[model samples]
Target: MQQIDAKQAMAFVRQRRDTTDPTYLFSDLDRERRQQAFIASVSHQLKDAGTFTDIGKMQGVLDAVSKNIVVDSDLNLIQLAQQATSLTGGNISFSTLPITGFGTSPDGASINTVDVKQVQATVKELLTPVPLAPVPTTTAIPTAATTSPAAPASEAAPASGAAAPAPATPSAPASNVYADSTGALQGGAIACVK
Candidate 1:
């Protein structure tokens, strides 16, 4: 829950472990997770601090970004700013592509390997819209006079003699190694990286 300057923020996101330290195994995936977590933290902080509403602060941020980053020649800053407003509401989310396993490159460098087909399928699934569950319709209960006695188990079986489909089970939530925590100040929470 500590506030950091620009340099500190950069270091926090870009920091990597020393391969010589056997105590902790280094993974590029972990570094990427840290970067994504840092972005979320910054987004929360900016929204909480009302930096977007402050023209001076916004201009200062824009100046820094413009000087440091190269954008497409056709890119419009105003349009980008408008799109960026979505971040203020904390609607942003990040997910990493699943890696198959770790492997050594031809150069003998360790790397994360991913299945191309699986990656494509995962990306497609992520982009696809999920249909909403249908709302249940209510039915009137039959009166005692109108209702008949329950049928025997053998007679109640389906005409096709097939069993009824099982109910769908909900999937478990994904585990995140990097979690976020609230800051001491009024500003938004900072990401707690592992």
Candidate 2:
């Protein structure tokens, strides 16, 4: 639940650029160009960012740059944001929703696109927990207990020639864990023309 301001994020992007183009202000880049450049730049930086979350830093990079930041969560987002900022030091987890497609705009601005329907489905799948293989455990098997006969007619077994049914054993429930398709935090290469 951490975020970097657009200007600072862009600064990181600029530092990572390998362009041979003439030096120019970051502002000079078109919106689409800035986004493309940012993605290309940070794709590698993400890996080296290191772990900032407990258990693990779930790494996720945006496929496209955003001009605004929104605090949306299962809990009161504003309260969560305030609490997060108030902490002197806290863990950060990165998560990404990637593009499923890409195309150029009519204005010649390179654009990255996503399928909203597909994304909705993917989001559900990504959030849903999966069952981990059950760990095999062994326990003592039950032994039949001996009984003493008191010659009580009412307590004696029925003489209908029927046998008693054995008891049924219970099984343990399957263990479930969240899915981690991205594997580990690592730098990835992005191809682009300066």
Each prediction's total of clashing residue pairs, residues at least 3 apart in sequence or on different chains, is 0, 1
Each candidate: what lDDT? 0.64, 0.42
Candidate 2 per-residue lDDT over residues 1-194, each given as its tens digit: 23579787766556633366658433323444555545444433443453212113321222121123321122333332233232222222223455755578999975668788877787776556564445556586644533444456556674498774344545433322334443431122111232
Query: In candidate 2, residue 119 scores what lDDT?
Result: 76
What TM value does model 1 have? 0.58
- List the candidates' TM-scores in order: 0.58, 0.28
C-alpha root-mean-square deviation, each candidate: 11.7, 16.6
Pairs clashing within candidate 1: none
How high is the lDDT of residue 50 in model 2? Answer: 37
Q: lDDT by residue for model 1 over 1-194, one digit each (tens)?
A: 88889798887778767567778876787788889888788777776776665666666766676586643344444544444556655567676888999999999998889999998787776655555455555597778844878577666655486885355655433322322233222122222243
Predicted model with the maximum lDDT: 1
